[model samples]
Target chain A: MSGTALTQQRDLFARLVTLGEEVTDALDHTNVVSTLGEEELNRAIAAIGDRALPDAATSALAALAASVERVIAANDPHRAIDWIGMQPRLALTLLAATLNPASLPKDVVPPSSGATVAARIPAGISFSDAPRDGRAVVYSGIQADPILRPLAVAIANATPAERLIARAVMNDPEPTAAEAAALFAALPSHRTTTDPLVVGALAIGGKAQASNAQYRGAVVEATTAEMLRRRPVLANDADRLVRRERRFAIDGVSADPHPFDVTVEAGPVPELWDCKWGARGIDASLLAELEDARIRAAGSSARIAIGVVAFDTAAIVAARLTIVRAPREKTRFITLETLGRLAAG
Target chain B: MARAVSTPPDAAHPARRPARFATRGHDAAAAHLATLLADAPPHALLIVGPRGAGAGTLARDAVATLMCGEPVDGGPCGACRACRLIASGSHTDLVVINPTGESNTIKIDQIRALAAGFALFSVEGGRRIALIEHADLMNEDAQNALLKTLEEPPSRTHVILAAAEDSRLMPTIRSRCAVIRLGLPDAKQASELLGERLGVDAPTAVRLLRMSSGRPGPLIDAEATGDAARAHAQIRRQILDFAATQPHARLGQLGALVADARAILVAGDDDGNAADGTESDDSSDDAPDVDAEPKKKSPAKRSAKPTPAERRAAATALLRLWRGVARDLALVSTGAVDQIAFPEDRAEIEAVAHRLPPATWGEALHAIDKTLSALRRNGNPELLLDAAALSWPTL
Candidate 1:
């Protein structure tokens, strides 16, 4: 190659490097990173890596992608539903379609953006007169709200090891505030990296609007699972699965059944039911995975019965062409309306 | 997914004017309203449904049917002078009111005008029907003003209160009015309806119906004005072109795309691009709060957030294009050519489908679904689009 050709190529190569850094820096602050997020970023990068690129530029591009991936991953999961008043099934299902199957960093499903279990309150004050924030309100020393009462009691009531979580949330002044306090009680370590994706002039701009809400976003997600646990029809139906005196309610308890959100067994076959309350229906991946779980569980029992019940949500299931004529047929999509009929069945 | 639906043609009734009671999917609600007229019509009627779910249309139809001199078998004879006047929105007996402020609230002043009109005898000597569009847009004060009129509307007068959702209405208003909730027709019904109205084939009707969310009223308007096909075609083209465009260029394009999306969804034709607007439920009116006091809006709200009502209606409308594109991509990836939303874009969609494994299309579809949710949830548009750009398969 001529020296001039090499020089032009070098300039182009330098620009490409700069471009990668710029996109990542821009993406870090953008919703794209927060939405497609770490899992998507990594997978896309891996796919690109499978393609051939110039040896000299490969390392630089890979490093840029990695830096972008880390920056995106380090942040708290964006509370995707915060703006809306009530969860709408279409909104939730459409949002679910965007996510890949790789679990979130804090894998627990987030709460309905506008919904929380109505807290039990002290006498005399009306429901509207109660405090809307996370802090457990007290009036004349009476516990004014019961949204967090379960978690508070659970922490106080657990044998020994469980107290550690309760103690941590109590110590952290931030998470202890709001209707989501019980949610805050069970939280991963709250921290964010100060590192930038690029050096000097290429450093990320306008990144991380760090605030109390950032930490609160992830911590509050814990309560949504708990809310689903006490849901009348779901809990009652799941109760039929229990053979022993014990009932499974923990979010990610080691002893809890796998491949289904709530599992129970009364007959020869173990009955698995996954429950969701997002206004929007679920995405194909979540549905596909659960259906696969049912197929897997079918080997153990004569009749494998698995059901997914949602409140105000539907699933946009995918199909494998001729074998699967309708996505709904493969995965029986049950609504809260249908749950009433299943009460006896 | 806003793609062409594959519905079997019902050719005998190529143009079945099934909107007899001014509704398509709401047969039961229409029947109930008809039954009320069988004796004495209710003093106040609250018609509720999701935005674009045809509450406004039903309200208007009820008024037209009530006032039409030549009543058909069940409802309004569309050929009558009263029906024509109502269709033109110039009838003296048919009064229409809407939100007039940035907060999108129907103030007490509008209610007062409605009262004055209702107090008078009908010019055509028919029932005085005051059709309040977006009745929930009435704040506490406006609703209170409405409550009095609703309490005992004149013996011969009728007030049809239309709302996107019932919760937004005051309890007093809700309690006084008999409610009629409307829903969407199944895709098949919507397709047949659209094909008849638009003078299109069943296949084209189904595609258009899917995009319009199966509402014949909007589909017909969009077809005449060409906003539905125009916005979708341009947006779909832009999405396909996104792959070849530079990463930096794509960033700037997102702002335009989002803006166009909001307009197409919220203000179907008012933006000059839309042919005509949907009924009073013109959520396709995704215009920025330019009319409102801009200072009152938070910086966050100014950028990405839509009102809760718009989350499922207008705001998500733009995503219909994306949904269709994603759906077609998934179909192509899965080798389901017959189910493609955009047959014209098949070559491009198939090529793009090849870039990612068939399974990835499911994730892409889900991702778009999540994007819509996030957008509705008020997630920043730039941030949300950026996430999608990151996740999209690279060439």
Candidate 2:
């Protein structure tokens, strides 16, 4: 193959793989959008009926329909079930076509009734070879195949162009400039260039920015730990006073104790501190740890302080809100700027 | 005939005695184990390493040292009554548990029995040691059952868990045990050991060492290792031949490729199962019959037809090997021949690499990875293989 043709083939291969991955992710229920309910499902089908799909999506939908028909025609129930389960969008399209044959465009047609539709039913759900009358039976069969519902939901909720963009971004979390350009070129021109999905994909696709953010996070963590270690109370007896990435046994916590970023033992009460770089770093798990520490220190004269030292003001606020249940006196939600004071106190 | 002098009972079956704990290229881990045995050893110890890297050997040796009447240089003397019994797999106090039955998992019942046994006094008035081989295979309930014993074991009891993949183990179980990680042994030591064990010359031993990736487990099992190596060689040739064919004709080679890959995996498993069987028979005869189900079922499974799970596992293993081949081709194409995995098949690899651009090899690798991912999710093997074959660059 010529160089240009080879490149184009590679690009096409990447897109197909990305779509497969997204379908798998949807099956695994890790997609950003949740599965559509009965009402929403009907609305999506109605909306799709009115919209004029791009040539690529129309072809893709048609291809999925054709593939389903072929698998059913092969008279292999196993193959038919597997083929449908592998692609959520295909399963959705099939279900939509079965529900309302008139809803889809003339180019894409649902599989005809008889043994073809009967074979498409997953064997796990029903072994009966009899043709089902209602859309309910077909819907139930699709539901029995675990990947179909969530995948169909994700596909139906998002436009074809949007799903394509999402899959591309998902495939390459950190794409190079040239890769980003190629991705943009592949996207349908109908979708607005200024859409948030397009803008977000471009922003995150910059490999340098992702690496820089990671580097900065590491630097902040190290710097915070060093500053805490340099405090007068913690300086003289370094080993005993400060520990990094250490897990301490607390009474109430079950299983293994979480490894705190920094643990200071110089004060009367032991202090476990975790350093967060940005607002996104503050989460529920951090709060649970603080609460567990609080429970362990209950009814004791010496109060163990479970803290989070965040660099961002927003993170500190979020941490404070997240740990509202924990006693204020027993918790230390501070910033790096106040690390020295907190350590000294 | 001259009057026969009376031999000691322990010396009656000298050939049957357990071999002294010996390993190649795990000096630091061995030393640490020795130190722990001599001093206050942890109640629970986790020996983490790849399968065939000698984690099982290390764990067994550690147990022997703990139970030995006379330990020499922190190892079992192999002459004492305890050592003799342990070696012969008749030690009353030593218990070994492995994944058993069709599921191939260490179940909660087996673990509960082990815990129950530990609650009692030692049979021979020495330290009671339990070695859990392939501990990573233990299901969640089994791991949880083991956690209580790991946290607070009875006096004079030590549990050693040997696992190929430590990540499969629960964090609670891992945190409770002192971990000893075994890595690839030193090249010189491994080569010498392989040579001595296989009775091969230095150059052949060196080649075998490289092929086994410096792992003593595969090298020591000469027959299985040899079979696997031969299968791998055949696979390299097949890949090259397939690459030379037209795109449409390449599908014809899929069956041969899959069969060759499965052969390689089965060869490794045959040796592994044999080793496990011997160990199980030796240990279970004297210990409690808690793992009786697995013991009874393993031989039958071995002789019978392969289960679907086993076939899937073999297919997964083959895809992994194919991924490596694709990566090696890319490396060879980029003039990094030294980094290629199959250095022995350099000529064939070069011939294949010459036909495709380095980028094409990368694409092939990606395609294989996607196929592997799909297979793991229980996709139809035939369909996935067909797609993979179509994706590869045609000569």
Candidate 3:
């Protein structure tokens, strides 16, 4: 934490808070908060965080906190702590930093000290570490399940190379030069101080973003095309379903208002996918939005749970990363490795 | 050119590509790739499968499709010169880093070299495709170096990691690339494909397919490796006899057998000169004549102990042999006789299966697996084998 880094981080926090406030106020005008239950508010907040908002703003932060406060009308002390347990600590810190204590869920106080900011969800994990101050994010929880234990350890004790790899895989937006140097130095040969991010961008032609978009498109189309090539599963399934990039409007006939990145409506529920590649890859926001979509589409006769398919694993990791957002137990997260598993399922 | 005629005239055929991956169980993968490339393939791929699963072939095919001017049939149309170069592995645009020989470890330098090459423009005016075979062998640094390329590869570049064990790869590496795991073909599909491709009869095809766990790659390429298989079969029989020996005598016999085996295979080379030789000679004098060696009179002067490499290879081969035999017993016990790797040993296998219950074979398999695990962790070969001999079930 250099002084400059601190300033930049604070600026980022401020900007994020301002954005959240604008969104929150818009929702308030529509009286969406009045209709939302605590679970839904939590889901909405998770979605907003997924958009990569980290910095904060004063007025907007309070306003956003106020909007959510209306949904959970409690002054109970334990209630606030419980609410804080599931909340994205960093975003909530920024939002609540300026709010009157009453606006926060009953007993919850934002992480400004040694509070258990990040709670361990599994009943057995006894993690209780909070950030020492407003400027840090501490991870103290451990997953106790046998299957996940190894993965948790591996993640916790990730080598520098692994960290670099994770950052790259996630397409983390702000990979430092130090990471590049560390990555290069860690390798047995061809050690250099040159940035690896540059190396990545150049591995594919300057057209990676464009290329991935194509890959994303292909995954959607080719899976369908392969099915078509094999023959129709049911007669005229293709005729009944149309792929919609737009969200299916409330009026039910808009060309462009689909809640997802790609949607195909051939089956009982339209297969909704939110495709992304990069560091901010899979986050609380997308899962939150997808969760919201799943909730909204529950009443539709031909609705499917919004499925997430990431070309990059970072998003999947993010989806699993329970520290920031609540673990999306219900959402289906798909990656390249699990393609066969999904197909079989 | 008269080269292109069916229902329509063709300029180039897909067969012009250097290698063709025609596996039955992986037809769906191949077809899916074709469909993906029926438009444009993804820039990075993590191909997961066991060795000899046509991982390399699929990678090449994908590259060929990407770099070809007028790609056809999910691959490069062969009629073009680029396709021919791709087939011949002479195309400048295609770079394959095979971690074989002294370069068993794909180090960071190799990836750096690749990154440098990728940093430049493509020579063939098409996508630059780099195939990393046995990518799981890459040292951690190499994988890290490769991260950059994986994240945002060069312009018109496609990087494919052909890995045997996906778990060996960093999850980040696994995450960055799209993974496609190739399945082993069923016995019937393998038999059909082996018969069709190699023109082998149903019985031979079945045996080959069974030996390869229903994967046709090894069977298709069997002609090249047939001698080694035969040689190892003989070696296995010797090891099995040693295993059947009384426990008290096993260690002494094992030491003598290895020395004799090494001497016979290495042409009595006293100088450990052939330690790193890739191929062990198929022919070896079976006589265990430790007394016959001229240097036997002077224990201090005996200069012909196997080199570390030879010793390691021998240990590995022994473990493999034990595993193979134990596997046959287990398979027979399970009544999966058709899945036996050594179809020719049916009589002996049946006898073993009948003489001992499936539990005996199961115990043997478990012991063998444990021994192999210890050996992998750099256990002293002689000591480990001695322990294994006592613990292993007698046929």
Candidate 4:
């Protein structure tokens, strides 16, 4: 290991010793010797290394060790383990950095930016390389890192969701941006990223505001569709009933509606278009609106033709669509041939 | 087999002997007497069966033979004065107890009066004949009152009791007397009887004979009264209507009629009401016979109620109507007839019936029988009725 890694490991060990001392003193003496014997205590001490310790950490560890020994001698080893287990603040400090690798400072600097602290660490000195050392670093880092301390506090207090997140972080790799977004969406909190690290990353990506904005837009669109679907005058056609383009000003002037994400040729033909994504095809109601549009375009030099468009994440494709006029009504149904052509495009 | 005891001279012989039942041939009646009546004799005869099964005719035949002064072969000599009086229904000694005011049962008063006649010594120094048309209807008290007379019957007495079934009477009452069970006649016999005896047309005779369910009397009654076709039609309509409404009612009607036949079966030997007396009280004389036989007193048997049997017969009649409906529906479905499906409720019955398979009609008939049986067992009549009505299988 490098000199800096050794120094870090040593520092983590000193802190763990202080924490163990605090836990030991807080407990009775018999347990300290009998259940968490000298060898186990040494192991726990070694595992924690130089993690951070609180003010009464050293004396508390000594007292707690003594108590664990008493409990074991009294034929209650589980009590000794439980008594020590109750020191969650100490435990969280021990695990936070080691278990949650993402919380570590990014070693690789961003391209075209200054050198990063993460780049200084050698490649693949994996989190498990120094398990004993890693725990101490986690404990110390949690105490030192302002952003991680509250999470550590939550873990120490045993909040259910925080505990779940801790356990998940312990067992799995750090979440990606998309996964983080899903997590934030599921969480009941309305506040934005509280952690400076998460806030900085989100601001850099310009994603925090965009995600919330998209959610609102989706909600509004869904609500409008639901309202239209419920209206008897709409005849169960959500698309035909909701014409968002008809927004009017107090002057009774309305903005001309540009076809949504489409281009039209002025070939003496008025064009109608329907768009959907992933080739899922257009709603049946949209075809009816196109039929009405065709009628409105009649008696002009413009000969109207209906258009169907299918879209993927990349780009949209357009195709000529065949409309089956209603036998009774003037509305029409777009044929499957039209849908196929759009998908091919 | 017991020989056919001749009627004494005092008893008048009808000019025409009573008609015979199919089940109770002359031989069985004689044998029944040999087995049951030989122990304690009877002075009067009672006859009972379904109306046209000829209980009256059978009684007349037996009485005339017994009172003919001299009988030829086991039959009466028609030319005798006794025969003439009995045939004319004017014989004083040959008494009959029929229901009063179209009542289905022979009341205890009627039976008691008949007993008075049996108590009197015969004026002609011979057997005094009394025939009861319906014997099983005697309630427990009436049957009990008649016990002593049946146990130690008078001398110079020859009784012939006829019925359609032996089950209607108490076993105690049944044990005391000879039993003659009458059954439906064969088609040819019924036809011949209807045409030759009643002077009905061939077609009418054939229809009446078949519709009479093999009882010549119903046929004769129908012919004489000129209401055979009409009564049959009315019964069919009633059955059809009631089949849809009250399943147990039909069965109760049938059971009541059958019970009446059974009741009268035990009375033929005790009273002359079975022949032509119309209303007589001989049932009181038989009541004591039932009470005295404590061993035979069935606690399970309540008053001899024929309602269940009558209801069952009525249900059977309903089934018969369903059979007609099934035939008509089948004909219509197969293009064999252009007539309305159910002439009474043609529009609706046709609509529903046409949607059902032909076999559903048969199922409906079977369901009616089941419902009848269920009702007789004291099951919920409404449930059975609904089940029977809906039992028609779908097409």
Worst 10 residues of 1 chain A by lDDT: A195-204
Recovery fraction of native interface contacts for candidate 3: 0.00
**Judged by DockQ relative to the true structure, which candidate is superior, 2 or 4?**
2
- List A-chain TM-scores for all predictions: 0.28, 0.35, 0.33, 0.21
Candidate 2 docking band: incorrect
Give the better candidate number (2 or 4) by TM-score: 2
| Model 2 stretches with alpha carbons more than 4 Å out | A1-345, B1-19, B191-212, B218-222, B225-227, B266-307
Instruction: List model 4 lDDT by residue over B1-395, tens digit each.
Output: 13223332222322222232122323344434223232344443444445435555555556666667655544556777877776687777766665454334556776677667777888776667766554565556656655555665666655455444446666666666644544444556556666776677776665554443344453343233224344444544443353243222333243233333232222221111111111112232221111011112121342544343333333333433444555445555444555532344444445545564544454454444444444434332222332343223322
Against the true structure, what is each candidate's TM-score? Answer: 0.44, 0.50, 0.42, 0.34
Which structure is stronger by lDDT: 2 or 3? 2
lDDT of 2 by residue, B157-274 (tens): 9898887777888988888777888776677877777667767777666655554445545546433345555676676566666566643355446656766655654333222221
Task: List the DockQ of the predictions in order.
Answer: 0.02, 0.01, 0.01, 0.01
- Measured with C-alpha atoms, the lDDT of residue A227 in candidate 4 is 26
| Tens-digit per-residue lDDT, A218-334, candidate 2 | 333444455555455455665556655555553422212455666665444566777765423545577677667556555333356677765432112322232233223234555
Error of 3 at B373 (Å): 0.8
On residues B1-395, what C-alpha lDDT tens digit does candidate 1 reach at each position? 11111122244223233346756666666666665554466777777665545677667777877888887755788988998897787888877777776576789999989888888877988778887877777778888888788766776888887776678777667777777766765567656666666677776665555455444544454343245456666777787766556433454465467666654553232211122111223342332211111112222243464443433343345455666677788889888988775777889888888877876777777777676555544343334454454334434
Stretches of model 4 off by over 4 angstroms after superposition: A1-345, B1-51, B100-103, B224-319, B323-362, B370-394
Candidate 3, A89-174: lDDT as tens digits: 22233333222212221111111322222222222111122223432211111111122222222222332223223323222222
Best TM-score among the predictions, by candidate number: 2
Cα displacement (angstroms), candidate 4, residue B16, comes to: 16
Quick one: best lDDT, which candidate? 2
lDDT of 3 by residue, B276-356 (tens): 111112121121111111122122333565555567456655565567777777889889999766767777777667665
